[model samples]
Target: MKKKDKFIIIDGNSLAYRAFFALPDSIMTISGIITNSVYGFTNMLLKIINDNKPTMLAVAFDSKKPTFRHKIFKDYKSDREKMPEDLASQFNLIYRVLDVFNIPKYQVEGYEADDLLGTLATQAKDKGIEVLIVTGDKDALQLVSENVKVIFTVKGISDVNIYGPEEVIDKYGIGPNYIADYFGLIGDKIDNIPGISGIGKKSAAKLINEFGFLEQILDRVDEIPAEKIKEKLKQDSEMAILSKNLATIDCNSPIRIDIEKCKLKKFDEKKVYELFEYLEFRKLWEKIKKMNLMEKSLKDENKFQSRTKLIVEEGELINLIEKIKNLKEISIQFLGSNNDCTGIAISIKPDVSFYIHIDSKEKEDRFFNLLKPILINKNIKKIMHNAKYQLKILFKKGIRLQGLIFDSYIASYLLNPHFREHKLSEIIQKYFGYIAFFNIYSNRAITIYCC
Candidate 1:
């Protein structure tokens, strides 16, 4: 039997930028400092650990100075603008988080993250490690080896398509080894790599896979039927060479750090807890304390035990209402669909130890009947991660939640609007420092969180 092996690598800068722009420019630290990118980036890293039980992990970042590629092609990456001033400020906080997680971060002064990733993928493959390179760069495709796979973030880091040998063939219509040649023939407009003038993506893939390389395709110009392609390849010979050099990733950069430095370790709860407290994340504080009990069991080596803490039937109505009446404050977490919920599946918790399911009409009435009395009273301060959505649904049910107090999502946004996402699941993952989850039932397109 072949044992499963997973070696994870990340493009830290790319992931952070994608996450930063994915949400609104919200989420901030105390004292009016923005921490949106910090929040989003940290949650992404946590997501990978909680989902994939990778035996080894590393994150690679770009150096401040120009890489060797820039020296080769002066215009290489020249078109891109500087990162937002707000985003640049939060970069260090993300780095501190990596340190807390005991994850290895690799960077070389003259080498880009692609170089570090290429070298690591090659090294891991030699040692029988199955590498999963997480990056937004297409240049990392060249690093895909037989034992290595690439997971490109598709939409919002919410979904990813795993590209192995077969997937590469299906997706790009070329193998890993031929990606450089393909890039060489068809230029990257983003990187300013000048490819053959007339040759587009379709022609480039065919020529690269058929002739084996950019140089070889040029050599056999007589065989190429397309006169435009032949002329472009012949006339732009210098551009082809430059493009290949730009496209080919430098695997032998001087960044010789070991993966041992990147091992996932215990997050300093005190540091994270202090940060949350400083931000006034009380619900977040509670979630963290709860997960601390299961921290040792969840982190490191990428695994966690998910179990049902409680499940109440439709008949357990009064017991739940009786439970809610005594509580002064509560955290409301709505599960099921985000849309209209008359078919609204709701769950309300007056306390962490007690979560009541309102799946049926009987239980929901008792839960809301108790909740309705409080809706009119302004003294009873209420808290919900997303108060507006809950407000909309609860209002439809004749419950006007008048005096809502706080929203972790809103607080997180004010702290750093650039930090963007606001799902209960992600908020828990970020501020609470725990992996928030909902076991999604595909048929119903419904998500139910198992606390």
Candidate 2:
């Protein structure tokens, strides 16, 4: 027997809405594009992709037109508030991001995202594809079964509670199949769907669990021990049935499932990086950069040319700083972590760069003492990639660099923003069409120098 491949279906609109609310609306790029919703949705997306390692994926979005449920009641989800303009603005960007990832997205004019997900999940499960439906809606729990599970966003965007049929039973005191029936009796106030006038959760669950489904419960409503409960069920019988119909997800959406199109593929890194740059999603880019595929993509390092001369001795460091003191423009790369840096690399020209090892206190002191003046001088331009990181490393040594004339990182951000990393290798290959070759040692700092 072979292991089954997993197919992950997502409710895009619901999760996007959930994400918009989960994060602060103030999350925007420097250019002033709101990204909280996209951030939240992407985080959930990356988490699911990484955690599940699903081989097939699809995201179903809701159409603007009313679904069949609305046609049935005209008031289905009518009470729900319209989406805010801020959230509406992010949908396009989110869709662009999805397209960059090569993930298939589906939307039908007459159905909700959940309905599409339910349909796809059913098809996937029947075909022996292990199906996982990811959504922020509880109504999705109705689709949970042995082969199909629901990953429900519980509190925050990333925080989720997975529900199998057994979990659903444990949660609601009824099986997954009876979730719609439960809602039909109690009603969902969020959607303005009406149920029996006086029925509540406890009564709904008790009736659904005992008699199985709304129709069966209605068939035996006359035998209820409580007259008030029985009377409510009988009086609003039509409402109970209507709510059940409303609650039940249509597992028969007209949309076709294209497993080939949805097959998990390498994400378009350039496009994703571009979006991240425009969104000013620095941390998110770093996370994406660490993906295994990205790591593999970075292995093609033929374009890099080694540019720095290693300065192991204190005298060499003093000479390097002396050369920097007279230069009009210079680039420096700090080689170390936040706690401790091992060395620095300086590039005075495209081909002429120097590296200084700061292993000893005397060498470190000499390097900073000689270079500090040029950094503070208003004339000599300081150029570097991710200048803030270098500044932080230098700040750790009590040196405040001032002549911040150019930051390639900021320049690149202004230019494209989506390039994966501002490392010399990428920058050179991108702009100069050349490889930037440099050796990275365990004991040395990682730095890129540009002039």
The segments of candidate 1 whose C-alpha lies over 4 angstroms from its true place after superposition are: 1-5, 276-451
Tell me the lDDT of model 2 at 124. 89
Can you give the lDDT of residue 199 in candidate 1?
Answer: 83
Predicted model with the maximum lDDT: 2
Q: Work out the TM-score per prediction.
A: 0.64, 0.79
User: For residues 127-237, what per-residue lDDT tens digits would candidate 2 score against the true structure?
Assistant: 889999998888999999889999988887878899998899889889998888888988888888887778888888888767877898889887789999988888889
Model 1 global lDDT (CA atoms, 0 to 1) = 0.69
